[model samples]
Target: MKRFHVHVVVPRLDESVRFYSSMFGAEPSVLKDDYAKWMLEDPRMNFAISARGGEVGVNHLGFQVDSDEELTALREQVVAGSVVVQDQPGAQCCYANSNKYWAQDPAGVPWETYHTLGGIPMFGADSRESAAPDAGGACCAPVTSIPAVIEKKVGCC
Candidate 1:
């Protein structure tokens, strides 16, 4: 795979960007009004930050797979290793389209394993009526509001 991935939600975009840029010693590879990403070679990590108004802490952790096969392997391994809370084949998130599998660690931290297919112009797309609800919720909606809705609809949260 390409690298390990980490996504965090912060309270302020500009402040967080400056903080991470100084910490990483490089400007963001992708920057937007509320999101920024660093493709750091030193540690081989894809670190992303967003001021999308969440709980203001570590949001999710992940691995960036090299290909669909690699993603599939990881998903399979995860399903075998832990209970997969959600799986989305064409998830639109963080301005990209990805195939993702979500699972929660024992500590209740969500882990995302995905292979990014390509970029999109938006942070998130509205789900089709028949589509399964995204575990992360739509657009910049509060993550806290999602679990109850998801659990109600799918019996998993």
Candidate 2:
């Protein structure tokens, strides 16, 4: 089985948590100082919010699969195309351990396909900041294969 996922960044954690809890009609399944996640079975959506972001808005979108086979299939599908894909096995993030693959839409919207392995005590394993600012600081962080922004130089004639 797969669940549709959406992650967002909020400026105010307390206010956002209250709002989302009320909106979803339930409290988050996982709550941390900087992150909160709601595994909404009723709506079949994995909604998450985080405060450790550079901006306050939609962070990224993703799908969470139930098994390694599903995750493998998902990664294969993404890598089959020309778009670069970064695969992270046993990556720790969001107070959980997961195996996730990441890629970006043509518009450069980061999209992830992951399978949760189990829960962890901390947010993530990264001691350093996320090079991918759009990607939060965690194992969910984009890896080396991630594309760099291209700057087209304009010359005044």
Candidate 3:
């Protein structure tokens, strides 16, 4: 089944954990120093978080595959298109020992199709520092009302 997965970066791990636990009646399955994850079967999503700037929100949105073969097939499919692939076929990400296929749409929004081969020992897995970052260290920067001062025009706002 196709499920929607979201990874959010939160400022306070404890606060978010408590809130989500209370709200969803579910606790995080994987907890790390700066990260937490809740893999829900009912809703069917791999919701995750990381510690940074006390700002809470989504890191990326993507799908998880059942196997490495599926991931490889996705990579080929993505490569067949005009999308630029990164992390290639054999790269570890999301604290999971896995292979992933990454590409950006025309507007530069990342689309990841991944298969988790195994889990990593660490909990707070920061994808920004580990993998792709936009030019500098800007991963999910907010759009400014002042369009004149915007460095990159992603049409987010």
Candidate 4:
């Protein structure tokens, strides 16, 4: 199974959490000082919010898979469609360790497909050798791959 993922950067964490909690009708499954996540089964989505001091809007969109096989298949499909892909095995991001592939759409929105391995204490640490020099301390997608305009508008988790 796969869950749709959406990470958004908000100006205020508390206000956003309250709003989203009311909208979803549930409290966050995981809440931290600067981050919150709701593993929603009703809509089958992983919706997360953060106040990481970047542009205030959608940060990134992704799919979370259940198994390595599903992740590989998703990667293969992306590759088969002629999209360039960046593989980050054991990526530590959003307080979790995951094996993920990052890609961008034609309009420059980043899309990540990953399978979570486990949890971590910190939010994320970008350790990719090819990570952008000016990532602005953001995690998930490689900022170098995103357009300059879009990069400035998205926040890191």
Q: Give each model a TM-score.
A: 0.80, 0.85, 0.69, 0.87
True-vs-predicted CA distance for residue 123, candidate 1, Å: 0.8
Tens-digit lDDT track for model 4 on 1-157? 9999998988899999999999999999999988999999999999999887777788788899999999999999999999877777887778898998877888878787889999988777656312652444466555554456444554332
Clashing pairs in 1: none
Please give the CA lDDT of all the candidate structures.
Answer: 0.67, 0.72, 0.55, 0.79
The sequence of per-residue lDDT tens digits that candidate 3 reaches over residues 91-111 is 334456656555555644445
* lDDT score for residue 117 of model 2: 86
Maximum-TM-score candidate: 4
The model with the greater TM-score, 3 or 4, is 4
Measured on C-alpha atoms, candidate 3 has an lDDT of: 0.55
> Which tens-of-lDDT digit does each residue in 1-157 have in candidate 2?
8899888878989999999999999999888888899999987989988887555677778899999999998788777877788777877777777888777788767777888988877666544333433353443566477764210110000
TM-score for candidate 2, please give it.
0.85
Regions more than 4 Å wrong, model 1 = 128-157
Model 4 misplacement above 4 A: 127-136, 143-157
Return whichever of 1 and 3 wins on TM-score.
1
| TM-score, predicted candidate 1 vs. hidden true structure | 0.80
